[model samples]
Target: MRLIRWLVPVLIWLAGCLVVGRAADGAEVMLPEKFQRLLPLHEPLGKPGPFDWLAHHPEPGQTFGQYVASRPVVPDRRRRTIYVQPLGEFTEAQQRIVELAGRYLRIYFDLPAEVRPAMPLKLIPASARRRHPEWGMEQVLTGYVLEKILWPRLPRDAGAYLAFTPTDLWPGEGWNFVFGQASLRQRVGVWSIYRFGDPDRDDETFRLCLKRTIKTAAHETAHMFSMLHCIQFRCAMNGSNHLAESDRRPLWLCPHCLAKLCWATKADPEKRFRDLAAFCTEQGFDEEAEFFRKSLAAIQGRR
Candidate 1:
């Protein structure tokens, strides 16, 4: 069962690689010079650590040109809004993280982000619920929530419909748990805050939880846009097999991935960096704020 769970993602990734290769024609559009300039700032992915995601599932990396040629999904005028749905209960601190995450998504994607009223966990039937045999913790079926619950409720104007839950999630019988799951074609996704730690514990913990939540929010949403897992750099879109690997990932997209986002959303690179920088500054993410500031400077030809 565990082997099957792992093989599914591997097979999907291999199939995507084939699609990307076949789609790579001379029709690939060139990214702007400003975006090209930032490429050097990012480091190419190195050897995977012992427990890294790459070690388990090697992925053929996608380039900016190939991404364009692949005809990846992008937001259209008809689907301009990004809707965030709250599932189940959340602590006061967790609720704050959700609100902040929504705000970050708005700035990140340059789209209108709305959080609908909370939906009760009671909506998940007993058949879809389980208690971990070893950990003894409650779990819910991620596939059930994503396909049955979120997909049906997806809004007409939603470029992406994301569900933020406070409970733990398992993809199916084999997997123990997953931080999140998404349907790239269906444009719907769900993520759990269960392993992000208690934000209410302390200021530091709150910030940590907020950061994790935001990263997952942005990363998963990118998937909805049909962006594949990044392998070019230490990017937000990089796949992570565990919490530590996820923690090691940057909170910002690298140049290649950024170009895809900019092209898809028609966002101005400089303005996008400035907006992200300002948000990070306001949220007391000094290091991240500094990085965005540098990115903005680079895009403006000042650095």
Candidate 2:
């Protein structure tokens, strides 16, 4: 019994380390082709670069990158509440984000997700904004700080990948300058859609980044439950780096992949997931609403 306890922790820790390393490698999700000009694949904005959350799937029995997307999402006879604990300086932001994320989960993932009232996501603001001429006074987002915000949350090892994203990098009034970098192709690995939000503006990036942020939150959370990139199918799991790539990819997972999603999450495919169009409509994404609606019906009907 003594040996088992000691060994269990050690083994669990070792397992966690491997997953953390894989997350750090990042998944390479593709964005919609039309939005590619705005975002791009090499950047790894919404989807990861090419990294799996567990670095690999935890339960390899059912499938590789696909989780039964909605099966585990069934109504919780018991209350289901998730919380975030932020570390370092910006505790309030982290806590509030957890609440916002819950709102998003219930709406998009169709999960009755809840946020615990007392639990506050810890926040550390050492790397909050950056110093840039275009960004005005306190606007800093100098670089990708996932290592600061997220990676440290890991205890050496945990899941497959570490999804590190800032609020968002949607185009604003001065977006042309922010994204009009000459290094778009050469450094897709290092370069992302965000440089800094407009210096003179207020919270434009925060609001605009909502759509992409939800995509990322849902994607990363799926990783936590042992889901993989839907790349093999023309679905959201496809790796993308730019906005266009994200836009091009449909919100629905493919049938084979959906099967895996069904297995992992145990959600009813017919009921749990909101038809892509419905999801888009709820999100006020009128642009792709019709397209995703059609896609979801076609995909679900066939199966």
Candidate 3:
């Protein structure tokens, strides 16, 4: 009993000394400073919590001229082209990026034959990444600037943001949070390799995560069209969770946003949208294929 008393007092005194020192230094006493403390509180704070993307806009400004100057363009005006050009030695998940992005471009924004799609998704040699290690996770999405990638083929009247995510995302575990981006960029990219197969499945613990990517990629591209994320009505651009969240999202834009996109791209709503669906099915998205079909029908019915 005596030993316990002495030991307890000393321990208490030491703790008090540390606390006083910390207070003197103006250090916070956040409980989760240690993993053990945070273990019981597994849930992250805030809505759209974790795995969130671009909390803000880029400093240089997200514009066409600046975006075009970032990279060189290569012409491939064939009716439909999806290039998976390797930027550097990339992981299989990264290399598959083209087909992944192409999967959505084919559905959401498949430009006509005149508007070629030059997706910069490839597996370059290790030397390439070594040469430019500073490239971010979402780097090279627009490796080919807007004009360079779409000019001579399609009109230059839009912007594109590639929400590159590490291949290990799930519904919500708060992966890859470096902070400082605007809320507009939150949850930007959906669950790829973050989903199912694609080899990223082994590392990713959930199977449902696979399908989520399809919806996400398409969602981000929709933003490139000058359309704000959906606010009214259940829409494809409503922002999402699992594929269901995305599925709940309608394929077409809200009437307001749709009007804006139409004004920006000036695509003949019915023909261009229907044709885009045809292109997606050609690439293998029966689900989105059907979605786009209905989207075209919905707009056409209005006309």
Best by lDDT: 1
Q: How many pairs in model 2 have backbone atoms within 3 A of each other, for residues 3 or more apart or on separate chains, i.e. clashes?
A: 70
What would the per-residue lDDT of candidate 1 be over residues 1-303, giving only the tens digit for each residue? 999999999999888766654665613445557888787677877889999999998998776777777787899999979988989999999899999999999999998899888999999999999999999999999989987899888899999999999999999978899898888788999999999999999999999999999999999998888788988789999999999999999998998889889878887878889999999999899999999998888878886
**What TM-score would every model get versus the actual structure?**
0.90, 0.44, 0.41
Best by TM-score: 1
lDDT of 3 by residue, 1-303 (tens): 999988999999889856744553223222222212212212222234243221231122122222222231222232223222222233565445445555545444444311223333343222222222333333222212222322323333223323333432222123332211112222112223423344444534222233344455555554544344543344455544443345445444444434433444444556656766775566455765676666565554431
Prediction 2 global C-alpha lDDT: 0.40
| Model 2 residue 231 CA deviation in Å | 2.8
Please, what is the whole-model Cα lDDT of each candidate in the order they appear? Answer: 0.88, 0.40, 0.39
**Candidate with better TM-score, 1 vs 3:** 1
Candidate 1 least-lDDT 10 residues:
20-29
The parts of candidate 1 lying over 4 Å away from their true place are 1-23, 26-29
